[model samples]
Target: MSERREHAEPFPDGSHGDLRADCERCFALCCVAPAFAASADFAIDKPAGQACPNLRQDFRCGIHRDLRKRGFSGCTVFDCFGAGQKVSQVTFGGQDWRRAPRTAKQMFEVFAVMRQLHELLWYLSEALTLQPARPLHGELRLALDEIERLTLDSPGALLGLNLAAHRQGVSDLLLRVSELVRAEVRGSKKDRKKDRRGADLIGADLRGADLRGANLRGAYLIGADLRGADLRLADLIGADFRNADLRGADLTGSIFLIQSQLDAAKGDAGTRLPPSLTHPAHWSPGDRKVGPVVGA
Candidate 1:
């Protein structure tokens, strides 16, 4: 299945959202602008300005179907958060970097900036949908609008933007939202002191643990055994899920969980997911647990 589902209705009112990647309308900026190192994730080392070896004249990956077999599994997990298309069509006025050599450097620079802004938009959009965060909805909407405005700025203005400062402010707001929502989980006595933002959790045996409303932002959960873990309403914004075992886990109401994160992790068909997320094509089939929202 494609990473982006067309006209995906993610809003509470069942309206369609525009924060999805439409590759057909893009200039394949992600294939050209980002650098990749020679590792298990990528077959070759590519410098920042150089195009990937697998990138074709039409800007499609030469081995898209067999990316994992060819050691390019990293590509499967990477999501530009629709920034590639926004930068290609809006910021650069539909002009391609290869066709317009003079604007190539500037286009790449602006693309990096736009990617960060789009990620912020993704988080802000999700935060607005949470009922418990109603108090901060006005502030969240304002931040989303301000970030959207910055994405429309000229290449020079985008390059000069202090994105780190903006991200810090947004992160703070999201942390507060997490507290408001997770606090309301009935019968959930999960430890509040265990909230670790960006902690190294490699190979953690947290199977069957109750992680409801936990702030696991940026936690390194690579290879963590999380089978049957209750992750309802947890804030997993920037969690590193590579190789994490999520078989039979119920993540129905998890916040800030995205397709890219799922793609990086390991799971089975039985792994319960939110309505907005699709099961990864690589998962094994089994009778997994479904979240509380379903069949309630």
Candidate 2:
């Protein structure tokens, strides 16, 4: 998952500090590198490699305060995991696409590769922090270090990377970590059925369900009613939570839960989250009735 630009309190040791996006250090790579279709998420159809019309000369979104209202909700949830800044300042040596039009195409290509590599770094960094996954920490660290080095490769080298194969290797390791961590939660043999990996739960009414230790990786949970659900120790990697109702849900110990997922869902102040995550500003301070789930 990409990094969000929201202001969050840094980890005490600041180990994952660079994993978060620093828009000020970036040259608006996200606005120019990716193609955007006119959809519920984006207000306009934008071709790849072209800067969004809303992008300002200072590299800030012109509708920053009213992106959603202006039909650019998609822009608000995108997080490059610091890839924009890394590509702008490190890969290209602080040269922006506008300043070096000849290199703009190559820069956009490298940004794609760099973003995925940085995402792996984010997941690996989080895996190391899970005490239950201590046995795999050494492997995770080595992988993280390797990917971190790859992010520093020259643009040509970055573009040549076998990203799919590399991502699969790292994904296999993360699955192992997920299993190790989820094993800590004692559950009845019947509860083993909670292995809903890649389950199609779209628009399902799952209010107050006991999802503890559930393997929900890649589950399509769009528009699901997850209010007051116990998601502690759940493996939520890649779970589609768009429009999911999380009001009063307990996710404090949920594994692999990221901010982008929360940003897309509806939550209230009563939603309990991991210490590493912050509540989305759009979440209501108190409980509000959620509308009926709309089909994807």
| Number of the top lDDT candidate | 2
Ten contiguous residues minimizing lDDT sum, candidate 1: 1-10
Residue 122 lDDT in candidate 1 = 86
Residue-wise lDDT of candidate 2 within 180-271, one digit each (tens)? 98886746786789999999999999999999889999999999999999898899999999999998898877888777888889999788
Show where candidate 2 strays beyond 4 Å: 1-12, 286-296
| lDDT (Cα atoms) of all candidates against the true structure | 0.81, 0.84
> Residue 225 in model 1: shift from native, Å?
0.8
Clash pairs (backbone) in predicted model 2: 3-79
Per-prediction TM-score to the true structure, in the order listed: 0.92, 0.93
Report how far residue 168 has shifted in candidate 2, in Å. 0.5
Evaluate model 1: give its lDDT: 0.81
Full-model lDDT, candidate 2: 0.84
Query: In model 2, which range of ten residues has the least summed lDDT?
Result: 287-296
